[model samples]
Target: MPKPSAVTEAPSVVGSRLRQLRQRQGLSARELAHRLGISPSAVSQIERGVLQPSVARLIAMTDALGVPLAEVFGGPEQRDEMPEDLTGFALQRFGQGTEMTLESGVIFRRVSPGRTPGVDYFVSTYPPGSAAHPESGMFRHEGYEVGTVLSGELTIDFDGERVVLRAGDAISYPCSRPHRIHNTGSVDAVAQWLIVHPER
Candidate 1:
């Protein structure tokens, strides 16, 4: 299996940022935990950087906090580089975009120059033998996702069906269905992914 590049940003960065967003949203840790169906200590652990959340858990937190997944990867901070009155376009230089690597070894690299209220744009890399959801379980959320594989093999297990994607293959599905993204190939699987959140 190909080794992924070492990502140096500590998990604490994301944990602290998540805490900030939760507080800004006026949600108590316990309340957020309740919403996520997890325990308060789990939330606290994540905020304190003692624990790194899985991809599904992180997405659930973002959904609970009403922020796009990119925000967890420093989207708001990246926007600081843009003009206050910026209107039409945004640019993210190569290797300059923020990224968040989940505890699952799946890396989500933000490609969008700024936050899109109900959308997430990024390049997701699934290391060999890595899966997005924890413990081989399925994850469901409120959105629609489309991914185009760039290299290696990416497998989508959804609604009791399994589909394998290779370079140049694309797949789209409603997030409401239980699904999992896994890299079952020997090499790293890289793909461009976009998720459109359900209208509020």
Candidate 2:
């Protein structure tokens, strides 16, 4: 009889891979759970190898992590090779982007592939009652952000000023200002964002 492939779908291996990928993307367990549309506890279980992910869940996760499915199964050796066209234009499919959930329940999905230097583009979702920071406290980063609400309501507080936005509304400001965002509506809010980082 032929020997089985070493790359079996072992729960422990999968869990380790999952954890590594999540950390590489700077996501917490809660954030990954939110992006997966599952509970944090479930993510904990999955990471600890206490639970096995279904095929569908695995697919969703790989898509969210912005990695090819093979990377998850084939281990680290598989990641060393890059596509020849990585620096050029690329297409990201619907439901296929690097996604992470914030501690406050905000989901950010990177729409662009590879690094463009000084730019980050994303599609973000703010669940009802979610805030950009705990207690909607002010925070600052070294960049400029522009975003437009696609649906539902978004409240932005910047440098002591507050504004309510609805679908089709857009805002752009320097991230140097202390700012926070809140989802003040009962429905999920969606937005598209483009952030430009100061040249290093």
- Residue 170 lDDT, candidate 2, scale 0-100: 95
Maximum-TM-score candidate: 1
In terms of lDDT, the poorest run of 10 residues in model 1 is 1-10
Tell me the tens digit of each residue's lDDT in model 2 across 1-200: 54212223446667788889989989999988888788999888877778766423554575566554344543565344335555545554454444544445566565554444556676778899887666545756556889999999999887758899999999999867777778889999999888776655
Clashes of 1: 0
Worst 10-residue lDDT window for candidate 2 reads 1-10
Clashes of each: 0, 0
* Candidate 1 lDDT tens digits, 44-135: 99998999898889988998998778777763557455455656567765556667788779888877776466789888889999888877
How do the predictions measure up, each by TM-score?
0.90, 0.58
Candidate 1, superposed: residue stretches over 4 Å from native: 1-8, 79-86
Model 1 gets an lDDT of 0.85
**Model 1: how far is 146 from its true place, Å?**
0.7
